[model samples]
Target: MISGRRQKKLGVRTLDIAKRLLDYGFHPPTIYFPLNVEECMMIEPTETESKETLDEFIEAMIQIAKEAEENPEIVQEAPHTTVVKRLDETKAARKPVLRYRKREAQKQ
Candidate 1:
């Protein structure tokens, strides 16, 4: 288990990185745990993972880092490729969308 700290100077939170990873076809590491550490990302690569997979993850991370510096907005508003865009977690918590709606029926 290796935990890496985010660069506060980049003005990007661990959540942002995690979300952005989805766009890169990867899941983001666990973030903001071990309360003692600020802006922490914990990655535990299992033995089942191949070197090629790890290499790809590293490349994606490097790209994200560059994006964080070059265009923070891209990193801030991540997972652009996902079916659902970013959600307002605070608002969702306050007013949860409990029921599922069929899109076709709604269109009718």
Candidate 2:
């Protein structure tokens, strides 16, 4: 349960996060909006990096998964490895920023 202000703050934080994701060489993961549901974040390093990079990514993912399972808080505190920080995900969705142009603009 959060207010619009808190949600906006989280949204800004998430936006900052999404920006860094762009540097990953792959697009950022899809973010839902105006709908309220738990979000899923994913990263398939193969989509963006070389074999060596992907291997490093896989290793990190494996380690992260293990740590997250061992202590869920670790993952919750993740995105830390990233430029972004953990946030109330629900807030992220209620408000979002679109990377692509507006649908109407695209159709024009």
Candidate number achieving the greatest lDDT relative to the actual structure: 1
Candidate 1 least-lDDT 10 residues: 1-10
lDDT value, residue 3 of candidate 1: 35
Q: What would the per-residue lDDT of candidate 1 be over residues 1-108, giving only the tens digit for each residue? A: 333355357787778888999999987788887667777778888999999999999999899888988898998998899999999989999999898778996888
lDDT of 2 at 49: 68
Q: After superposition, how far is residue 47 of candidate 1 from its true place, in Å?
A: 1.3
Q: Per model, how many backbone clashes are there?
A: 0, 0
Per-residue alpha-carbon lDDT of model 2 for 11-107, expressed as tens digits? 3333333333343433554443324633334443446568887675446445544443455443344455445555565877887655866688688
Off by over 4 Å in 2: 1-48, 81-84, 95-108
Pairs that collide in candidate 1 are: none
